[model samples]
Target chain A: MSVTRAWAWLIALTATSTAVAAIGLSGRWLALVVLALAWAKAELILNRYLHLAQAPNIARGFALGLALFMLALTSLAVAIP
Target chain B: MTTPQASVLDDLPGDLMMWVLILSELAVFGAGLMGFLAVRLTDPPGFAEAQAHLHSTGAGINTLVLVTSGWLAALALEAARAGRRARLRALLAGAALLGGVFLFLKAQEYADLWAAGLTFESHAFYTFHMLLTGFHAAHVLAGILLLGLVGWLATPRAVEAGAAFWHMVDLVWVLLFPVVYLI
Candidate 1:
């Protein structure tokens, strides 16, 4: 996608995330959704904004790292408290 | 002169150093997030209470501003690639201006928090909150200066590098929002 179109998606996603947070979600469900959304937004930036998609290996590596990181944090938040 | 495609990266868009900076910055932010999580999970009640005082409106506004600025930086990079000097300069300046807006809003947020007597010692949560946002703000400041310097230089490599750094800053804030403000 063109930079403009990618940016439009980012802004729209931000608005959606903000709205979701504002409405107040709770428990493990909230943790799951919020972490998932954050992961998706980060992926969007890495893939589109940073142009990492051109190098598939680098892109996959970064995605895996982010997934692991978010999974750990989400687990800590949801599993324990 | 070798065209950009012949410049060794073959697939990447910018210089090696900018990628290094990007990776390092991400690592640092990742560590910070982990640290914040460590403390937060320890005192869930304390953190949640302090977190409730946080103003998501400002965080959300800053998110919108930073993301838009990151787009402007991307456009500047595109213009640089196309050898559109004037467009590149204009986009860089616009991006820098938006970065300034981000800083202004961030400062306003900090000032409000301080006015309300939330300091680094206010609580463990506030400490991490201040550190994470403060460190990220420093990056935004550095990025604004880099954007202005690169706009004046107008070199494709320099401009792309600045765009990379600025976008990295935006990306950090993107991850930080849910962890620090909402969650």
Candidate 2:
């Protein structure tokens, strides 16, 4: 698919997740939905729109760093409670 | 013969700079989210009570504004990539204006809250509320300024980068609203 089409899909996904999140459904279901959407959106933005897939080694490292940070935080949310 | 090569090289640094700025901004917002979670977990009842003082309707309106602004920023990025200068400028301006409206509404909310005896030191919940919203408000202000700077720079690539940063700001708020208000 084209970059624009991909981004549009990502945005739609995020919008759907945002709507669900706004409903204040705090539980395992809400956490699962958020994790799914967040992973999809982050991957699409990084690989497709940002073109990080073609990035140099150092840039790729930064991308990995970002992913790790996000993962750590999301894990914290799940692990804490 | 040399012009195109020079331009391509110039583009790389600018694009990289934009990414750096965006990543840094996200880090700040991430920290704020962490703080919110920590406080909420530590004092659930207090946070719930404090949330009562917030106007859900107002937060709902602000969410709409930020989401619309995110859409505009996406449009701006597309226009910039296509080298549509006029469209980029107009969209960026519109997004900045929406950010301004957000800040104005937020200020009014704060004033009203204070008048009703809700201050930062009022309680643990109120303290977190003020800190979270206050930090987000500062980000909105920064975003408005960044958009203005992007307009002044008038570089197509820079405009695209600015749009990316602005969209990230809006996305953070999307997560923040439920955490602060509904949750």
Candidate 3:
């Protein structure tokens, strides 16, 4: 994606995540949705901003690592009250 | 054997060592975040209460500021590669200024919380908050300096490496904000 386009999506996702919390949503679903958005934003930065797209394997590795981290965090968040 | 295909490493942008550094930094932050989550699991209600005192709105604004700065830094790299020194400098300066804006907003948030009597000892949540976000804030400060140095050098490689580091900073905040403030 173009840098500008990636940025627009980043802004949109950031707004969505922030508004989700601002609306006082809580619990498991909130953790799932918000962290999912965080995952997407991280992917965009890794691929477009960092230009990891040029190296597909490296990009996949970074994505996988981040995905695992996000999953663990989400699991912990959901496991909370 | 047929001629070896170009190494995947060859396609990776910037210095290989920079990517190594980025990966290491990501691992450290990821571990820190995981620890925060594990601790939050212990007393969810207490954690939520502490989290409520945070300024999510300011952090949200900082996320926007940071991503915009990363975009500018990316463009700076392109300008450097295209040999447009002036545009390169302009974009780098813009990115660094936005980084400054992020730091200013973060400082204001910290000050507000401090005045409200939320210190590291207030709760385990605040302790994690101060450490994780404080370390990330230090990175933003370093990134601004890196941008300035690379812009002065005006070398494509230098800018590429610098932009890579700046994006690492941006990416960390993207992950950190929700976990720390929102979630």
Candidate 4:
């Protein structure tokens, strides 16, 4: 997909997920859904929009660390209740 | 004027170290959200009552401000890519102004909430409200500082990094609005 198209799709997905998560879900489910949408948006920004594919190894490593951190936090939250 | 041949990522300037710095700031906000959630689950009534006091319209307006700033910052990035320094500056300034407006509205909301007896110790939700909004307000303040610096520097890389930070700020609000207002 083109960059513009991909961005639009990502935005739509985020908006829908946010609205649903906001109005309908709660607790672990809400956190999980929001986290999933956040992950998707972050990936779209890093991979598709920013084209981190060409980024330096160090930057890529940092991005990977960020992803892991987000995953860990979200997992802990979900596991709590 | 000759355009620079640098890739967007390559030209990203200033303390590239600031990216991680900004990420650390985000981690602080994330911690606040996690704490707020934990407290909410533990004391649902206090949280629910505290949430009821929040002005959803105000929260919605703040969310719009951050999102608009993000959009402007994105446009500024594109302008920087095209090497239009004037347009870039204008957009950066616009975003900064929006950030200012957001802060102003947030301060007003806090003042009103305080007047209405919604102190940090008032209830569980109030604690969550104050903590979450306090952390977010700090981010907004940081964003305003970054936007000001971007306006001053006007370098392509700085603009890109500024856009990244602004987008992150916007993203956090996207989560916060729901957690604080709707949910």
Best by lDDT: 3
* Residue B89 in model 4: lDDT: 88
lDDT, candidate 3, at A26: 79
User: In order of the candidates, what TM-score does chain B achieve?
Assistant: 0.92, 0.84, 0.96, 0.85
lDDT per residue, candidate 3, B1-183, as tens digits?
Answer: 799888878888789999999989999999999999999988888998999888899999999999999999999998999999999999999999999999999999899989998999999999999999999999999999999999999999999999999999999999999999987
Pairs in clash, predicted candidate 3: none
lDDT of 4 by residue, B123-175 (tens): 87777777778877887888889888886788778887777777667766665
Extract clashing residue pairs from model 2. none
RMSD to true structure for each model, in Å: 3.2, 5.0, 1.5, 5.7
User: Compared with the true structure, what per-residue lDDT tens digits does model 2 show for residues B23-123?
Assistant: 78677767876676676677666666777788766876776676567666667767877888888889889989999989888988899899998899998
- Candidate 1, residue B44: the lDDT equals 87
Top-TM-score candidate index: 3
- Candidate 4, which CAPRI tier? incorrect
- How many clashes does each candidate structure show, in the order listed? 0, 0, 0, 1
The TM-scores, one per candidate, come to: 0.93, 0.71, 0.96, 0.73
**Chain A TM-score by candidate, in order:** 0.86, 0.66, 0.94, 0.72
Per-prediction interface RMSD in Å: 2.0, 4.8, 0.9, 4.7
* Model 2 RMSD, rounded to 1 decimal: 5.0
